[model samples]
Every structure is written in C-alpha cells, then in structure tokens.
Target chain A: MDIKEFVAQSIGQWRSQRSAHHLAFGHFEAIRSEIAIEVVADHDPAVIELCKAHDIDPGSAVAPFRMRWEGQSDWDEEEEVKGTCILVPVPDPGQANRGKLLRDRGYAETMAAAGDYYLTADGTFVLTTAYDRAAAEEKIWFINPNVRCRVSLIKTSAGSGVVTASFSSEIRQEIRQEIRQAS
Target chain B: MDIKEFVAQSIGQWRSQRSAHHLAFGHFEAIRSEIAIEVVADHDPAVIELCKAHDIDPGSAVAPFRMRWEGQSDWDEEEEVKGTCILVPVPDPGQANRGKLLRDRGYAETMAAAGDYYLTADGTFVLTTAYDRAAAEEKIWFINPNVRCRVSLIKTSAGSGVVTASFSSEIRQEIRQEIRQAS
Candidate 1:
C-alpha cells in the first residue's frame, strides 16, 4: 500500500505488546497496552495547536491524527496510565517518502518536537527525532492489514558526546476488533 | 560479496562517530571512537574460551574476530579508554542469513552474550541480543569497502514488563589511515 493508505489504515483501536531492552544495565521488560487512533481534519483545533506549538504553519499540514494510549507496564503495574498526543504530518516537496512529523507531546518528553519521517521502498514507516538531550529512530511496518510491528532505538547523551543511557524496543500491534465486530 | 567475505573485509583500523538519543529524558550525546578489528581462526584459543563460556560447541563456529575500541565520549573526557571484545559466528542451519553471534564482552553489560545475527536481503548485518535485564538490536551495513553505517536500539526494564530507560543511536564509520593521511 502507499504511504497515505498506510496512514489511513492506522486509524483504529489497537492492542500492543512491547519488549524493552536497556543497554547499559542489561535488562529486559515487557509492556502491554492499547491505543486509540483517530484521524482529524487538517484544520482541527488540536492539529492547529500542534502546528503552533512546533512553529509550523497550519496550512502546510497535510494530515493530522489524534492518539490516546492506555496500558500497564512493568514499571507501573499498579496504575493504568493514559496519555494523549497529536501528530501532524507536513509534506516535504522534495521527496515523496519523506516528511516532517510534528508532535505536540513527544514520546518520552512532554515538550513539542519536529522529527523526520520517511517511508522505505518496502513500505516501512520510519521516524527519527532529536531532542535536547535525547534522540530516537523508530520503524513501523504492517505484517498484514490487521497486524503491525515497531522497532525503536533511543539514546540519551551525558556530557560532551558521551551517552549515559540507551534502550531498544520491539512492539507488536493487532486490531482490537474484526470485520464482523466493526460491522 | 558473501557474508564471509564481508566479515573478512571488516578487518582494519576504522574510526566511528556516533550520536545517541535518550528517549525518556530527551537528551542527545555524541561519541568519537576508533576500533581495530582483526580476524582470528575458528580454532583460536580466544574463540574456544568464548564458546565454552556460552556453552556453544567450538566445532560449530565459522569465524572468530577480535575488536579493540579506544576513544573519549562526552561522559568521560579526561581519560582515553580502551576495551576489547571477541566475536564468534556460528552458522544457523535453518536460515542462510541468520546465525548466532557469540561475544566475549557485550555492548553494554560485561557478561558473555550470544546474540542472533542475520544478513538482510539488502546486505545489512543485523544482530539481536537478550540479556537478563536488557536487550539490544544492532544493524550494520557497508556503504562501500571502506565506509559503513550502524543503527541500534536498547531498552532497560524496571520491573515486571515496564521499561524505565531507552536509547537509540546512529553511527558512521570510515577508514582511519586514508583520512589521516589526507589531513
């Protein structure tokens, strides 16, 4: 499927199983969560706000999505946590598979971020983000229409150019409901 | 070139520049280092020791290589550090591009690790390791005979299945001698 088609199919409820690996400490943890993804109009208030937060023109945005995540991880087993984020995609005229991924609230940090994203020839969606002290590259691909997988790498810098912390993760995603249920 | 030939070509003194991103804290760091890689026979004493440490039969190993790294990162700028590791490749009967990667010292933790290694259809060498509390996946590919690039992800688990830390990195590699002489 094309890049736009792939993004369109991502709008739904999904169950995700994730395995996280810590590099410095040599540790592994598993996390199970659910996310609800909804498509929003380019001019939606949330989309507009996200663009404003990242200093991008709202008119330049092509597609916007709203995401809500709820789950329990190894670190937070007692409480179910929830988070909301807005993703705005700004096209790059120079490249078909490349664009800017603007986020109102970033994955690990709450600050807004503008990250680079591209779709591979094989249809894998890849994103790379650089924060003040951290950076991440994530790859997401569909095994089928109903199943998806993600692999990510994150690094935290200490002083000079040394890295004090790092982590790797693998995530599996499945549609929450089947065709019959949706119908 | 074939996988064996590729490994053979990796022997040399090379320089690497790495950028690390910390996911949770939103930090970024840079690292500069040099590595000297040498090929060792499968029956070498170091290879035998590595196999014994990991409970792998030495007879099954295909190639063994030694690596020495020296450099200064942002975290430790005062002193030049040196570290060494051994890499042993054991063939996987099931898959042509897949094999076992046995190491004397792992990337983050010091304990011996036997990671899964595979060559992608595009000729990228990928390695995935699982440790007691951490896990890592690394991808390395050559841009040419003297240039290469690497990407990696590491995750640290806190408890149960929760990940408390994560990092991602991108590295560029080049031949050391040619650049030095040019300068």
Candidate 2:
C-alpha cells in the first residue's frame, strides 16, 4: 500500500496498551492510552507550516493528518501523558513506497523532525528518525482491520545503545456517528 | 514463563519466511528457510566450550540447543544461506526471567557473542547483542503453538543508523515420529 492508503486505513480512535523496557535503568513500564488520528486539510495552517519548515511544497503533501494522544504511565502515576502532532507525508517521485514524513513533534524528542518512511511488501510501515540526542525506529503492522501492533526503539544519538524499547497493541475504537431525524 | 520453558517450547523445526530491508542500499529482500532446533546435552562439548568462552559455568546453562538453518535469499538466488549455531542460556540467579545467552555465532557478525535476554510479561523473548561493528536487537513471540513471529534489527555500532531491519514469520513444522511394532 502507498503512504496515503496506509494513512487512510489508520484514521480512527484507538485504545493502546504499551509495555516499555528501559535498558539503562532496567525498568519496565506499562502505559494505557487513547489516540485519535484525524485528517488535515492541505491548506490547514499546521500542514502548510510543517511543509514549509521542511522546504517541501504544500502541494506535494499527501494525506496530511493530526494525531492526539492522552495516556497514563505506570512510571509516574501523577503525570499524565498527552500530546498532539501534525504529520505531513511527501512521497518520493522515484519510489512510490518510500518518502519523507514531516512531523511537528518527533517520536523520540518533542522537536520538529522529518523521518524516512517506507512500506514493506506486506504493507508494514517502517519509519526511522534521528534527533539531536537520540534516534527512533518504529514499525507498525496490522494484525487485522481492527487490531494493529507497533514496535519502537529509542537509541542513543550515536545509535550504539538503546535506551528504551517498546511494543504496543492498538485496537481500533471506531466511532459510529448516530443520526437523529426530526419527528 | 522462565527461560527454560521458553526454550522448550521453541524446540522444533520451523518454516521461516523473512523480509529484510537494507536501509543503506534501500533494497528489500525475501528469504525462505527451514530451521531445526534440537536439544543439546549438558555435557555436550560445544555447550561446554561456549560457556567457558563466556566465563560462565557449564552447569549454569539451561536448555542449551543447536539451531540449523537452510535458506534461499531473493537477493542472491545462487548463494544458499545455511549455517548452524549453538545457543546456551544461562539464567540470572536473582531474576527468573532475565539471563545471558551465549551464542557460537553472532547474529550481525559471525563470532562468538553473548547477549542479554529477557522474557516480557506476554512471554515474548527479546535479545540484544553488541558485536564489533554492529549491534542486533531481536524479538520473538509465539502467535500460537504452530506459529511465531520474529523481528530483528542490525544497527551501526554507534546505534545511530539501522543498517538492516527484518521481520520473520515462523510456522512450526512439527516432526511426528511413528513407531511400529515388529510384525
């Protein structure tokens, strides 16, 4: 599948259960979160700004979207995990399955980041991003239409040591809008 | 389950289908192989020698086994991928689910290597090894008694760049031995 189709299939609300291992600290943490992915208009301010920041033409953006997440982590029960990021995908003209993923908030860090992304033959989405202090590799695959799996690694800047590795299983929480007719 | 139990469950022949992406070259390769896992006796010479190489007591090794693989990669159809390796699992005395895994042949590099291994709450086995030129992260989990999944990453020594990332789906090829009484 191309990036647009992959993004379209992923548009929904999801209940995510994640387990993370901190190798440096030898700690295991559990997180439960709700994530929402919504499509963004190409002319949206966030999408336009993100494209400009990466020096990519706004017209080249395909299936731009915004993701918002809220969760609770066992590491610190008092602190809530919540954030949102705008993502814009620009497909390579030469390779249909490969492209750049521009993000307003990075996975390993909160800074703006652009990651290289590609789809495997089996339609698995793989993304890798390098940040100032760390790098992140993420893989996402669908087990079925409603269930998906994600694996992520946060490595040291040099990529020698992995500080954190995590696996998450997400189940889609489809929102069925109900219509009321005037009686 | 502990390391021993995990090893026991994995002792069998498997048909593995793997897809690997070499990020450096932006190439994708598919490999199909048959793998055999056989139990090794505690007194086996290879097990003893591997433990000694890692400076671990032979008696501490639990459920040692040898793995043999024969495969064909799409990248090189003429070159057959075939090899064998001895694996010795030495459980940590204090932690039941964590331990050291001594390997006769490393994943990223063909040299004797030791890796830290742990079983997650869901019984997924994760192993991380650091070799001279690269580091490897591997994760294996049983989807069912007859099916399993493996994910592996070979990264640069500094961990900044992922040279290769692979996903393998292994289906157990159970060997059923039959006994016939003398007629």
Model 2: per-residue Cα lDDT over B89-122, one tens digit each: 9999878899999999987777889999988765
Clashes of each: 42, 7
List candidate 1 stretches off by more than 4 Å.
A1-183, B157-183
Candidate 1 contains a number of clashing pairs equal to 42
* Local distance difference test, each candidate: 0.65, 0.78
Q: Could you give candidate 2's per-residue lDDT for residues A1-183 as a string of tens digits?
A: 999889998999987766665533334566778999999998999998988888999998899999999999878999999999999989998777999999999877779999999887667788989999898878787655655668777766886445566666565764211101110
CA error at residue B118 for candidate 2, angstroms: 24
lDDT of 2 at B82: 96
TM-score of each: 0.52, 0.53
The model with the greatest TM-score is 2
Please give the TM-score of chain B in predicted model 1: 0.83
